[model samples]
Target: MTNTNIQILQFGTGNFLRAFFGSMVQDLNENGNNLNICIIQSTSSNSLQQLAAQDYKYNLLVAGFKDGQKIEQIREITCVKDGIRLPDEEEKFLNFAASSQLKWIISNVTEAGMVMKEEGPFEKFAESFAGRLTQWLYKRFQTIPQSETVVLPCELLPDNGKLLRNFILAHSINWNLSSEFLLWIEEKVLFLNSLVDRIVPGFPSHLDLKLKESDPFLVQAEPYALWAIEGPESVCSHLPFLSSDSEVILAGDISGFALRKVRILNASHTAMTGHGLLLGIQTVGEWINSSDREKFLLDIIDNEIIPTINLDRDELKKYANDVLDRFRNPFVSHKLSDISLNSIAKLKSRLLPIFMDYKVLIGYYPPNLSLCLISMLLFYLRTPEKIRDEQEIKLWFKNVSKSQSEIDVLKTALATWLDLEWNSSFENAFNKVRQ
Candidate 1:
């Protein structure tokens, strides 16, 4: 009998992938489709061993509001057919890779995970994440010449899938892999850009011991989830599971969706964390649940952020509303302190673009967003986070020559941080507000 389940090899046994993608696949499998997954953590760490002991069965507790009412469910995932830890089970991992049924190469190895550090021309299973993946794909290339491979990278980095493919190709070049194989990779391989959103606070220590005792590999998550993938229609057609899954969108152009997410949800986190801290708010849900803070965030996003995005206004607003609903989910207690870490860069990548755009197009400094930036600066200046940021920035905030020109200096510093040219008009509103 042929095992008809669509074979997928996933990198990372972490909480996010398990709770987000893992649970989703489990859902797809249970509902209608046959999607079996093989798990591998592409590192020396034997993290999947613990997962193996649980017989690859884990409890997923999804909690949130549905139709304006509280709802929660605990599901046991059995779709995980096998777990392989790299280095320890390298042969087994390759064996799984050699499967004729393998379809998509899904990964959540994180932003820094897809790096290429050149050690030798190409040692098998090279040290860096990109290299190891190249070696594995080469093995796949050799074993399964007929099968079409699609790379679905769930990492949050911009152009993640595109960059990942490029990295692999670059590695292949450095390694002097055959031009035929390289051309095969370029011509045949499908690298689909993906964006994943969900709150999976792993092994909830905060939950009561009785609840935790439900399953050894218990994972807690909010009901709301999104997996936006931009890929070819044929790619979507291959995996019939996505047809059943409403949450996993097969988007036409994922950049707009990615921009909306990065600019709004993620940007808001950067903009509001320090302010939320000021309000004595602990979790993201707590902050967004507060009517006052929620309105404030909404105004900023609705007014300043959404207008700039090229997507349909109605669709953007709908997404914004959904974002708020996700934020208000009581099940996920996303710590403000956690989000505030490495925040300067977060602000640069997230909110700062909106700021720059508003300045360029609207011809006015965005009051709410500017306030958030000022608040972020103040928060970092006063707290232990000051040391965590660059010394130059900290010192610039501290030792600006003219005390009266603080707003101008702050604006200039902000521009410099984002590599934008500073304009006096950008800080003029802040100056007026101060006066």
Candidate 2:
């Protein structure tokens, strides 16, 4: 097989992209689609030399369960055409922006990366993800006058594509690009918000031994995967590359799917993580093994979280149970800490909606979810010791009462966060503090 024009320019070469997007491109190429991918390492200042020297080739081993049976797939991914370490050469990075063959741009740089920075597009140091994207979009517009790029951001943030596009437009004003280019950015580019679901816990250590004994290399994944793209009907019509039925969703509004994903899948993940961490469990399997952990998470969803959501209750519960089973797959080791990244932001996205919905539906406060709010407050308070951001800590505690006389500072913080002035002096305040 020969590599064709670079159709997919993937930015993040991490494990999530390897198992999710890279696997998709490899599968498409196997079916004779002639899709070549070039990966750009977001931060390779120290490791860029070694990664580039390898010519961007690596083995992937995906393992999971399907229908009560064990399944493992091993394959070497070779679609990576060229590697560009952004720190070493900025010119080459800019040139790729103008490539006419570049059709799809996918990234999973985590939640914080989506924030727009207060800098011009061409800022030399690449301080933020949105700023770099804005700079790249400008170059693309200059090089190809009338063409528009199809951007699909896989970050866990809601409406990430829309947020990124707004930042790019804001940057255009900062850089003083022509009104004609601004109009083009508005009319031409299709920024589609997406909800990507996949359980990719990176290379498995214990499985490596078995894989080496059998074929010496393998790449595996769970039998479940879903990509929900929220955009106009024409978006699906243009890309004839996706799966036919349940795998891909083209909807009028992806918010419902987004809410379902966050509340059930992500919300369950967080609740399980906190309880698991306290129980000294490290992996998802271990957490599921506990008699109370999984049941507690399900209780939180069914009794507390899911009822608050707007989706069809039966359908949502079915999807949630299916997702829960995948989490318990003995082969895949989804670590608790991995889900805990930027958890403050994660909690807002995953749990806050359920809390808000509970407020709207029950006309009363959700005490367990309020405990989660307290947990977040404590988590953020402790983060300053490591993160060294005192300003952030001060901002978080702004609503808290300083004097010990107002010993109910934590409850006040939670109520303010929940936007409910539900008597912070409730007896459950002590229980929530204990949780």
Give the best candidate by TM-score.
2
Question: Candidate 1: where are CA atoms >4 Å away?
Answer: 1-6, 31-34, 42-47, 86-95, 114-120, 201-209, 214-216, 277-280, 337-345, 363-367, 370-435
lDDT of 1 by residue, 1-435 (tens): 223353888888877788888877877777777788878776554567777877788888877886787977877878787777676666676665566788878898765465567846555556667787788778878887777787888877678889998998888888889999898887778888888777665666666646576566788787777888887676766555475443888867789878888887888887788677655677787777767888889999989898778889999889888878887776777777767655666776677778778878788767787777766655654453343354566676566555556555555666666565545544543454345
Per-model TM-score versus the true fold: 0.78, 0.84
The per-prediction CA RMSD against the true structure, in angstroms, equals 5.3, 4.5
Model 2 residue 167 CA deviation in Å: 1.9
- Tens-digit per-residue lDDT, 183-248, candidate 2: 888877888888888887765754635544443223446756778888777777555447532276
Using lDDT as the measure, which candidate wins? Answer: 1
Off by over 4 Å in 2: 1-5, 44-50, 67-69, 120-126, 208-220, 243-246, 376-435
Clashes of each: 0, 11
Residue 325's lDDT in candidate 2: 87
Clashing pairs in 1: none
TM-score of 2: 0.84
Overall local distance difference test of candidate 1: 0.73
Q: Model 2 lDDT vs. the true structure?
A: 0.68
